[model samples]
Target: MLTKRLFSSSSASPNLFKIGSILKQTRTFTDADVLGYSELTHDANPLHFDAECAKDAGFNDRLVPGMLVASLFPRIIAAHFPGAIYVSQTLHFKLPVYIGEEIIAEVQATSIRRMKNKYIAKLSTKCIKCNGPLVIDGEATAMLPSLVIEPPNLASASS
Candidate 1:
């Protein structure tokens, strides 16, 4: 079951994040996506690169590599919290994904605490298909700087 949460807030200066903050992104896996990942990782596993081989091996179809699916997790984190440094992540592969399947990655900020000079956020993360089957589930810990830094003006630097 996919339950979408609604948030309404009007704050002039928003904090970097808050507990319960959520981010979700969905992407449809493509043949190009699988091939590109395989080329990048040098993982030519028959299941990922060769559809005929995959079918022969008994999978319903060519399966998307687990890491390829899990990679979407970081996009959600970065979208919500840029410059947040990932300290650790634990991922569990729950289901096989096939080409052209849309998968959604959702992450929620579970805990935010000050650890020394930096703030650490613990996130509850999960990826699911459009039909609600779990593909990946795990937790991630990220360190957010206590102070946000504004980027320097490139024009000034170039002059």
Candidate 2:
């Protein structure tokens, strides 16, 4: 639960890949995104929608839905290492996320179950500028592809 260090990606790589560490994807929050998420999820909590209410609530502005922001982790992990099998994910919403705020999600390979052929990635998603702790802290399991290969196209098979 620390903000510093933690970089190992896999046990397989002596150069960079090792168990118990990972990297991150950075993103900025926008007002439209907050509003849209509120609209879609019906999470009209004043802290997330009403500017005045949010001001009163002690937030600089309306906050973002934790769930909507959290949904990006999978995409980030996938983007970092394409074709890796994602097996598990668990998120704990820590603090509120504000619109116009940028966040960086850090993912680490905590351990691996060799017999099961699966890897565990412990993740910390947060906004560095705000001085607040991670907005979301979680763990994910993914099966990293040992080699790249194309899967048969299901469209052609069905035809």
Candidate 3:
């Protein structure tokens, strides 16, 4: 069975990588975002930047790049799990996200296991808009930083 849950940023404790831990955030994909990403990635697809082309393609407005929509997952991880290293990610684009729509990106810890000295977090991720359509579905694996603490050096402190 598959479980689906939506979580808020404050719902999870930072640095505590526990199973079922969820983190989420929302961002509006604006024209500026699309333009900036296009300039950065050199992606000049008309569906993303040209409104007329998007309309011709049967979309209401210019479409946001799938990668741009996927980028929010990392921010959710960074905000709720500082020091976590993103090891891998997979995304499935479900629907096109139009420019100027606010979408929510959510990441939930589906499994947590200790590998060697660090914990590896397997997360279920997705992006949904205000109207309840999922724009992207994905999973990500993050290696949580070590929690080991070093012993205090009393000899050095005294010297």
Off by over 4 Å in 2: 1-17, 83-85, 115-132, 147-159
Question: What are the runs in model 3 whose C-alpha is more than 4 Å off?
Answer: 1-15, 146-159
The lowest-lDDT stretch of 10 consecutive residues in candidate 3 is 150-159
Per-residue lDDT over 22-129 for candidate 1, one digit per residue giving the tens place of the 0 to 100 score = 667788889998889988999989888777888888777899888888777666565455577888889998888899888888777787777666677787889899
* Candidate 2 lDDT by residue in tens digits, 20-113: 4445556777888877887887777878768899899777888777777776666655655467777767888777777777776666556544
Tell me the TM-score of each prediction against the true structure. 0.76, 0.64, 0.78
> Whose lDDT is greatest here?
3
Q: What are the lDDT scores of the predictions, listed in order?
A: 0.71, 0.59, 0.74
Ranking by lDDT: 3, 1, 2
Ranking by TM-score: 3, 1, 2
lDDT of 3 at 77: 67
Index of the highest-TM-score prediction: 3
Tens digit of lDDT per residue, candidate 3, span 76-106? 6665545779999999999889888889888
TM-score, candidate 3, is: 0.78
